[model samples]
Target: MALMKLATTWERFILKDLTKFGRYAKVELTPPSPGELGQVVKGAGGFVKDALTFKWAQATVKEATVNTIVIAEIACWFFIGECIGKGSLVGYQV
Candidate 1:
């Protein structure tokens, strides 16, 4: 019984060390392909179109204008942020 217990303890220690080593492994996220980028742009354009239509049909012009402007601004900033992130990634690769 004592020998069996010793063997089990050693096995647990080895597995713990392996788990620690696996935690330090590197991970990467590659850039999207041209086709994928095109699809994303198309989707964004569709969203802008929908927002415009909704704004035009609203009962209050003031609220509609504000919402439309906010949506457009957010979409522009999202694309700009993506470009900046890609630029930084390129620098990291070099």
Candidate 2:
């Protein structure tokens, strides 16, 4: 009975969270329209310009540390996904 109650509580929490994110996902997952594509290109250009300046250099040590950790997390997740896809950690089995 305790186990069932725990599972029910867990399910409610998950469903609530999923409902919140589903709204965001619906909007974010849609393909960008042509006008949005131009905006994206402009944004990319601005990002490149910022990267070339002292903007990044001005980041505090804490901000730089957080950014490095986030990037490392992304890289680790990509490698994990590749291993999952290949069905082996070391390499694809023949």
Residue ranges of candidate 1 with Cα displaced over 4 Å = 1-56, 88-94
lDDT of 2 by residue, 1-94 (tens): 9999999998899888999899999999999999999999999999899898968899999999999999999999999999999999898889
lDDT (Cα) of model 1: 0.78
Query: Each prediction's TM-score against the native?
Result: 0.32, 0.58
- Please write out the lDDT profile of model 1 over residues 1-94, one tens digit for every residue: 9999988997899878877767754322457789989999999999799778885575488877887899999999997887787786344434
lDDT of each: 0.78, 0.94
Candidate 2 stretches greater than 4 Å from native: 1-30
Candidate 2 backbone collisions, by pair: none
Error of 2 at 6 (Å): 34
